[model samples]
Target: MPTLPISLVIITYNEAGHIARCLDSVPFAAEKIVVDSGSTDDTVAIATRHGAKVVQQPWLGFGPQRNFATTQATHDWILVLDADEYLSPELAAELERRLPTVMAGAAAVGILRRSTYYMGAPMRWYRPMVGERMARLYHRGRARWADVRVHESLRWEGSTVDFAAPFHHLHNPTLVHKQLKVLRYAELKCRDWLEKGKPVRMWQLPLVFIAAFLKDYLLRLAFLDGWRGFAVAHTAATYAAYKRLRYFEMRRNPDSVALAQAELIRYRLER
Candidate 1:
């Protein structure tokens, strides 16, 4: 059986530790494109060694950067994967099987379930709500990423279908790493809020945190995973609270935007 031709597009910055594994997992791809922001690491070299065409571009936020990468692909059928994510063998085979149907216009997008690992183990109860299922496989001409920084998603008018298996996401390898990830994401969220002129509801701050905790812990069944679950739930709640607090602080201070910009600069430099 002949395999379907597709381009695998990935965006990276300082992902030296995981890029090779990510590229290796997608041996079926006809072409691999990696759009990288400036990295003072071995990310670009490793990706090139793994047969990915590496393009150097400065950070343009999540959605915009992904859109730029898609344009550089040789094929219309594109599969976007993060540096820390890779397809399971089952999922890879499923993609090879389904690509023909997708190219025939049966569906405009293919959704895949992602199972996230924390500290080298799968998180049984604390699955992130945003990435449960993602439309990572799509025809570039028919879809585009929404213009959001933290949790951008694909926008398409056609039908979609789910893949048979899940992709593996090695996200949080350590507690400190997890915290830093949350902080960075929260900072981006706060910036988005400020950009949209969204006002912070100072009065509902406590309630917002409480609701986040309950939803993740009780409603999402994070408790079933034991101490790790609790930690995930607590961290999620704290992220929500921190974003709100950051937004409020920005709203109150006259020099907040400058401060935020400085912090983002520092973040990019450190990474």
Candidate 2:
């Protein structure tokens, strides 16, 4: 059997902490490409040392950045991965066995289940069915990421295959990091909503939050995971509510928006 060639593509900024582990996990890759967006840390150096071709570009939005990285790959088959994610041993073996078949078949995209971990432990019962699966492997010419700022997905017209082994995602390393991530995502969501002229009704704020909590905690069976499940559900609900509330506040009070913008600028400068 002939080996299937694949290019591993990743986009990063200040991801020196996980770059080594991520690169180490995919030793079978024919080429490793890291498209960095001006990392202040040793991300570039780490990737280069790991035998990856590193390219620097300014921060494009998430979808654009991923698409840009795909363009740099020399192989036809590309596996897009986040800096905080890595292939499990089982997954790597599965890929090695399955890629040849997939390449010969008509499938243009490959989907895999991703098991997310919070603070070093897996969130086993959180939205098990819906949030776990993603399309990360695809032929570069057959698929492209949507042009959205947050929650972007791939657009593919061909058939897709689902791999059995799951990818390990180190979602949040700590509670503090989780909180910051939720807030930053909320901010970007609010900005995107405002740009798209999406109207937020102040009256729907509480209702939306309640619905989000119920959907995740009850319907999604987050409670089955214990305290971490509850925390995940609550944080997701809070993120949804906060983004809407922030958008409303910004639209209603320009003075508050100005102050918030100034504070953000000051914080960035200080950092």
Candidate 3:
């Protein structure tokens, strides 16, 4: 049989609940590489059991870890994935069939990401105004992950292809877990603003919140998802509120700057 030429790479940190399924969804890739950030759980075992090569490393932020995983892959065409994300069957098939021809010189491919959680519930309102679509497949030596601490993505060195088949991101379900994600993401942005000594305005917070809500709820058609859309919009509002409130707290307690810096340090350490 002709060999597959693309590799699927993922960076993980204690993603035991969803790693197996994510790896299982893209068996056609030439290789599956898992770079685990010292997962205490059976995440490493799980990846290996599913025929993926597992490498261990300390957390080093999102992009760096992904780049680290790329080192272990032998193939020229690479597909980067998250432990909680998977390939939709239709899209996977399409990629499998088109990649080699596309990979001949294609710089990168942007695949749609249709995310769900809480039992496949689509949280339309909470999703990003511009949802994330990772540049997964790209020729080796031509693509690399950026160095951003969060939401880092691949830097494709050539032209791009946009696929209609959406990747699936199964986010954590519990309300508390979801809120924590909001808090983590918000806290990061708040700290980013504080370090830069960005000025805060009384009206700006509410405006930003409203803008995010309108973009996601009204513009993104969150209404189509029913309750999920409402939940997402509400969560987005909560995140905006958290960012502003945290910003206020930092300004009021100048000493908290040290605390925020420490949290960022810990986050980078755990990445």
Best by TM-score: 1
Flag the better candidate by lDDT, 1 or 3.
1
Model 1 clashing-pair count: 0
lDDT of 2 by residue, 1-271 (tens): 2335899999988899999999888888889999998888999999999989999888667888888888899998999899999999999999988888897777889999898887568776777633488999999888999877667799998999999888888887888877776766666667678778897698998999999999999999999988888888898899888988889987887577557657764654211
Q: How well is each residue in 1-271 modelled by candidate 3, as lDDT tens digits? A: 2347878888887888889999989978768889888887889999999989988888666767777778888986778778988888988887777776777754555455565554356454444522555567666577788764566767766678777777787766677778767766666666667767888775787888888788777877776677777777778777877788889888889888677668755765323
Residue ranges of candidate 3 with Cα displaced over 4 Å: 1-3, 113-119, 122-134, 194-197, 251-254, 257-271
Which of candidates 1 and 3 is the stronger one according to TM-score? Answer: 1
After superposition on all C-alphas, the RMSD of every candidate to the true structure, in Å, is: 2.0, 2.5, 3.4
Please give the distance, in angstroms, between residue 140's alpha carbon in candidate 3 and its true position after superposition: 4.5
Q: 1 or 2, which is superior by TM-score?
A: 1
Candidate 3: what lDDT?
0.74
Error of 3 at 188 (Å): 2.8
Query: In model 2, where do residues sit more than 4 Å from their true spots?
Result: 1-3, 128-131, 254-262, 265-271
Error of 1 at 244 (Å): 0.7
Range of the 10 consecutive residues with the lowest summed lDDT in candidate 1 = 262-271
TM-score of each: 0.94, 0.92, 0.83
Candidates 1 and 2 compared: the better one by lDDT is 1
The sequence of per-residue lDDT tens digits that candidate 1 reaches over residues 142-257 is 89998787789899978888886889899767898888777777777777898899977989889989999999999988888788778878998898888888889888884976
